[model samples]
Target: MAEKLGTKLNFVQKDLIKKSTKEPGRVFTVKEVANSYGISENTARA
Candidate 1:
């Protein structure tokens, strides 16, 4: 059987990291993060 790649955080995580700063901390919920990056909530958690 072929091996499957593990799920990974999407663009939202990248954007969140970029948007987050020492001041704001860029903390966000899975849903919010998913919506921000146009990905599914489950994918966001991954």
Candidate 2:
């Protein structure tokens, strides 16, 4: 989705997104990832 939207994601964002997909334990939203990682929502979305 980021590729289609042309958003450049950093390593951390990429890792977060990857884990979110593969975990299958709990779903992560932008807000959840941000809170978990202590990052801003914009960074999570990136």
Question: RMSD in angstroms, all models?
Answer: 6.0, 5.1
Clashing residue pairs for model 1: none
| Residue 9 displacement (Å), model 2 | 8.6
lDDT of every model, 2 decimals? 0.68, 0.74
What total of clashing residue pairs does each candidate reach? 0, 0
How high is the lDDT of residue 35 in model 1? 77
Model 2: per-residue lDDT, tens digit, 6-36?
2576666677668868887767788988888
In the range 1-46, model 1's lDDT, one tens digit per residue, is 6554333544555556667864485568888877777889898888
Superposed by TM-score, candidate 2 places the C-alpha of residue 24 at a distance from the truth, in angstroms, of: 3.1
Model 2 quality (TM-score): 0.48
On the 0 to 100 scale, the lDDT of residue 37 in model 1 is 76
| Model 1 lDDT, full chain set | 0.68
How far off is model 1, as Cα RMSD? 6.0
* lDDT score, candidate 1, position 21: 66
State in Å the error of residue 23, model 1.
Answer: 4.4
Q: Model 2 segments beyond 4 Å from truth?
A: 1-18
